[model samples]
Target: MNRELQPLLDEWAREAGVPGASVGILHDGEESLLTTGVSSVDTGQAVEPGTLFMIGSTSKTFTAAAVLALVEDGVLDLDEPVAKYLPELRLADPVARDTITTRHLLTHSAGFLGDVDIASGWGSDALAAAAARFDELPQVFGVGEVFSYSNSGFLLAGRVAEVVSGLGYEDLVRERLLEPLDMTDSWFLPWDVLTRPHAVGHVLRDGKSEVAHDIGLTRSLNPGGGLWSTAADQLRWARFLLTGQAKDAPPLSDATRALWRTPQRAAACPIEQIALGWMVTRHGDAEIVRHGGNVSNLQLSDFITVPAENFAVTVLTNGVGGGVLGPKVVDWCLENLAGLPALEAKPVVPTDPAEYAGSFPTGDLGFEFTVRDGGLWARMVATDGTIETPPAFEVAFVAEDVVARAADTRRPLARFLRDEHGEVSAVEFGLRTAQRERSRLTA
Candidate 1:
């Protein structure tokens, strides 16, 4: 199988133009690791099995797990309001600030602006400082209104754990989570990662690969999307999730695993529901819980697990093209190794395409939907000049209110949200909500 996979991985990486890539798979009590390309184009160092790559938001699982560990230790409750721990918490909406809980944060339904990026300095107080500025974040919806991903909510959740455990977020995770599971290759700091064989993230410039200007995430957002890990280490993390058994890790109660498996909220197709830190999808009777990660537009990762099949796979890459490569690799592994075929989402054309055409703006990111050629077209806009704008592409409704790329419907691109009078009021994209730009709406 390694012999067959090596050439395929090599071909995929070359086609995707990623500088470095690694894959790990665990199936039926056996495991395999595969690597291709150099860790850095400048250094020309071969990617080793243990070379570290940023796992991005995939670290959210670790954050959620660390909080759960606290729950097992009788230090916290998921259902309790976050204000119980951070008494000084403030937000633009008092009701949401007061009612949001760890569960709400875990499930990405905290209702505040999810895309706010607070860059508190590199210190043990970073998460605390980031959570302190919540008053500036606008309320996108009422509490528990819908499923909009919130990195801010996760940062606050970590702050809750920090307050209760009397330890910093990184220290708590290192001591209670990674160290216990024997995941020694994982690190949360730049200095720590520099000491190991690590991959540098890359971006394409004029069709040429260039090192990304900024590769590290802010210390404040560490709880939301900051962790450097190897493919081998990620497989070990998945094993712990599979059986709740690890080298020195404490046992999670049956109820805790049930919470991890239970469907907390309904989501669009391709994602049947959202579980605790995992996206839950159904293929036949198998429950596929998975998550993908992106780091500053430089690195991309995909992690998947099937508990019933006792199978898991992870792909890590040092280039943005991994966005395309990672999913292709996962789908292949699922069908060949786990006998689970990937589901293809068919387009559902709405009766009126104009109903979804408008400008949805949120924070630094926005989307413009226009009616063209009797179909709906969409493109991403950068409102604050913090991001690069991309060209428009054709998209179609895949569900009653969901819009995805017409070329690939495997993942939802956005969901059109309606108001009390059933008028489109906002759009949920990249798991964040953007209110309609009524003044700039295209008729």
Candidate 2:
């Protein structure tokens, strides 16, 4: 692995204003842990390898793993409709109500809202109550259609595990995945996190870092992105996912595990690629299963595994730029650490540059694609003037309708929806789909 990861991490932590970060790598049965920055910028205490940081949506993989374990035991069927397990659950749409299955939820094709921002007031029935309101969530696509990321789906899946096992979701995870794997430094509550050597999440404002109000995820949303864990524990989790390199036997069957790792196909028209609970992206001949989390854009985490090489990397940052840090670290690890063949970059001009250029508006904020030095560039603009965004990042077309930055590979970011005549009509950006406007606006 990168013997100089310390200096490289120091540079990134300084540049990104990260208060604290822990990086863990598991390669060919060996594990290494490293730390940089401080647990608290306010106190200036150095961060230790055991210090806990929120893993965000990366927690989704654990939720997925636990469900798969249940599947292995025949307690749950992958194709069985979720309503078979949780009868109280209801969707805004009836078709999706009775038809959506465990498969849909894990793959994020349940066709409901990507996020439900409402939280219960800390009751034992918090997850259940929040799930009941799921019927109020709007449908973005039909069941098994588009691959919109859904926290509500996983939360519902967690409730299913609770109902089937007659155990709390937290406890179910503990018994099934944590205890068996021996991850003692992990936590699921803000209070528990505060009691340990923990890092507080930070948001940047006016060129300064400030503590985030939502330090940890709510109890109701625990299944989605609520877990806080050390980098060491995270690497162990990654090691388990890389079964060949795993220290212990996998908790799920090889067939079931292989099924979960494969990229899922969208039900409706063609859509972007997302594995059951992770992202399966191609880097030449190698396939990467990775997941990233954003805890209110405060704490950012990413876990990635390259199965062929028995390699994995987990990163958690208590800062705003956690979104950008993961790709940089993973690319370095894959190429420099694992010695994987790096995909060479090629310069290609779009057949019709204006076809890819337009005003893609999402509510009040939008993106404007323009030519910069004859290269395609995407810029973020505040249409209503409420917030100021950074300057545009240079994005180049890497494939048909796909774009990539030097540090970014997920592209089309949102697939560009087409009109009847094949002109770009709308663009899907995760949960927020924006329309193509006639003229572009600037901040």
Candidate 3:
């Protein structure tokens, strides 16, 4: 372990207004722990490796694994229509229920919207009510057409797990995944574990510290973002993912494991496509599977594993600085401790500076592309050519185009589609949309 990295980690925790932060690294079958900051402003308890934090969407990987276990036991089939298991399931488009399969939900290709509106609270009934709304959502696209991050998709997967296993989603996960893995400190209900000394999330409101409440804990979303876990427990979970060495682990077949890690389709990724609940990318010759979580307040978390490298890293933070702090911390560890090169900040290059500059349309949105500072920047302009309230920027590159950061938290440009001529034909501005040729304008 590099002791010198402690001060740099501490500095980020403080700068991010994190009440607490913990990082776990697994390399060559060994582990390293680092923590800093107080767990809460009120209690003043020092954050430690065992301090629990909301892991948010990273919980989906566990849910997906459990579902795969059932599949291995012949309790379910991935390609079969989801309606076969949950007959009551419905979408505004009746055909979707029949056409979309369990696989679609797992891969987030069902096109369901992310969340359902509900009263802010916790209870079984609230969860049931939210899950019941699945009958009303319109399909945004045909099943398996494109990838869009859909929280409701995973909720439905959880619901299917409940129906097929004859158990609640939380109970099934607890029995099959958590208990077998010995993740005793982790649970779906942090509120129930309130007696334990756990980090209380907070938010800065009007320069006053306010307690952060659980945002989406209804039964429906439990499979999506409801898991709470300590850094130590998360490290255990990370090891399971890195090595697939769970005692009495849910029966995930080798074939199923391969499919889970394989990229399903080219979704709207800024860098790489997504698989099941994991983010898929290549780092040199190794494939990386990772996921990130945000519980909406000052609670953020991320987990990354490189199976080929036998390495994994987890970053959990209690402050909500737009959720970048955790990822940045993880990146730092990968660079410094693991001896990997720092991820190069996206560089702007244009294959053809003139052809790259143009006006393009994305559904109802219009944008103007311009070149500046040896790079490219885009501004969303109204139909009448008025600048949108928040503008977008990008660093143009011939092969790996980089989207510059935007003030309103838009993703930096890191995507491009090539033309038949092998020139940059289309530019993708992060996970949002892609713009193709309009009229080439001079820089």
Per-candidate local distance difference test:
0.83, 0.75, 0.69
Candidate 3: global Cα-lDDT? 0.69
RMSD of 2: 3.8
**Model 1, 1-443: lDDT tens per residue?**
68877898999999988999999999888899999998999889999998999998988988888888899999899999988888999989888878999999999888888776788888878999899999999988788887877788889888998999999999999998888788999999888989899999887877767776677468888888899999999998888888876887454665786677678898533466888888888665788888878776688899999889989999999997897789888888888889986667776766578878888776656778888878888887767654445457888787888877888886677777889999888877766667787754453
Best by lDDT: 1
Worst 10 residues of 1 by lDDT: 382-391
lDDT of 2: 0.75
Which ranges in model 3 have alpha carbons more than 4 Å from their true place?
115-121, 125-128, 206-210, 214-217, 249-251, 349-402, 406-443
Q: Which RMSD values do the candidates have, in order? A: 2.3, 3.8, 6.0
**What's the C-alpha lDDT at position 102 in model 1?**
93
Put down candidate 2 lDDT per residue, 1-443, tens digits, no spaces.
45677788888878877778888888767888888888777888788998998898888888888898898888999799999998887788888889999888888878787656447866678788888888778776788756666788899988888888888888889887887677889988666778799888887878777776666457888888889999998887776676722435656666877877778764211233677787776666777788878776678888888888888888889886776666567777778888887766655436445666788764345668776566666766656553335457766565566566634544334356787998777665533445688764332
Clashing residue pairs for model 2: none
Model 1 residue 252 CA deviation (Å) reads 2.8
Ranking by TM-score: 1, 2, 3
